[model samples]
Target: MGLIDHLKARLGPARGKVSDLAQQHGDKVQHGLDKAAKAVDEKTKGKYSNRIHTGTDKAKGAMDRLAHKDEPGTEGGGGSGGGDMFTPPRTPPPTS
Candidate 1:
């Protein structure tokens, strides 16, 4: 197998564990993220507070997605179910 495949094979279990933990403690994770952002914002004197908040929000969103990856109807593309990791999300065509 290629290097990427070998690495994925080794890390698959770790990724699954992370997903399970994300699902189990998602609220706590989000809370911790908010607390950290608040601490950093205070330390920075609100200079980068907006950016920090944005990043924190994105991180939380990503965590939520990972936590819900196996739930029905949670796919980014609204997929039916069950596919490999590389399935492409369907996109709508642009209006003229």
Candidate 2:
């Protein structure tokens, strides 16, 4: 098997376990993220407040997806995948 395939196969079980743990401790994880963000912002004197909030939101979104919280027919389902992370932002056309 290819390296990527082998890695996926080996990590499959671990993924499920992590999903379960995420589901169980998601709130705690989110709380900790918020706390850390606050601490960082304080240390930086709010210089990176916007970036810190954005990063924290992205992290929480990832955790939710890892927990399958957006899967339909499941508890707490119906949330989106927080959009495509790889998609580039659209820019307005330049005026002539």
Candidate 3:
């Protein structure tokens, strides 16, 4: 098989496992993401608050897409493997 095909073959099961985990424990995963971001923000003394917020939001959006992959009306806008639901993106902080 070609390299891309070989990699996809190897990673296919992993993607399914991730989708299953995302399905089962998505909330906990998102919570952990938030907690980790908060810790990082605290350590940085809020200096990167904007970036941190943006990153956290992106992470959460990916998680949401993963958790809603198979549901109706979410195709082409979610994880290629699976998904749960949609969430509106948070507004980015205005830069000076």
Q: Give the C-alpha lDDT of model 3.
A: 0.79
Question: If ranked by lDDT, best first, what sequence of candidates would result?
Answer: 2, 3, 1
Clashing pairs in 2: none
> TM-scores across all candidates?
0.73, 0.74, 0.72
Task: Tell me the tens digit of each residue's lDDT in model 3 across 1-96.
Answer: 599999999999898788788899999999999999999999999999988997888788788776776667767654443322344556766799
On residues 4-92, what C-alpha lDDT tens digit does candidate 1 reach at each position?
99999999999889989999999999999999999999999999887797678668767876787787786675543333334355365
Q: Report model 2's TM-score to 2 decimal places.
A: 0.74
- In model 1, what is the error at residue 27, expressed in angstroms? 0.9
Q: Where's the lowest-lDDT run of ten residues in candidate 1?
A: 79-88
* Candidate 2 runs further than 4 Å off: 69-96
> After TM-score superposition, what is the CA distance of residue 38 in candidate 3 from its true location, in Å?
1.2
Question: In model 1, what is the error at residue 23, expressed in angstroms?
Answer: 0.6
- Runs of candidate 3 with Cα error greater than 4 angstroms are 78-96
> Which window of ten consecutive residues has the lowest lDDT sum in model 2?
78-87
Candidate 2, 24-62: lDDT as tens digits: 999999999999999999999999898798789878878
| Residue 65 accuracy (lDDT) in model 3 | 72
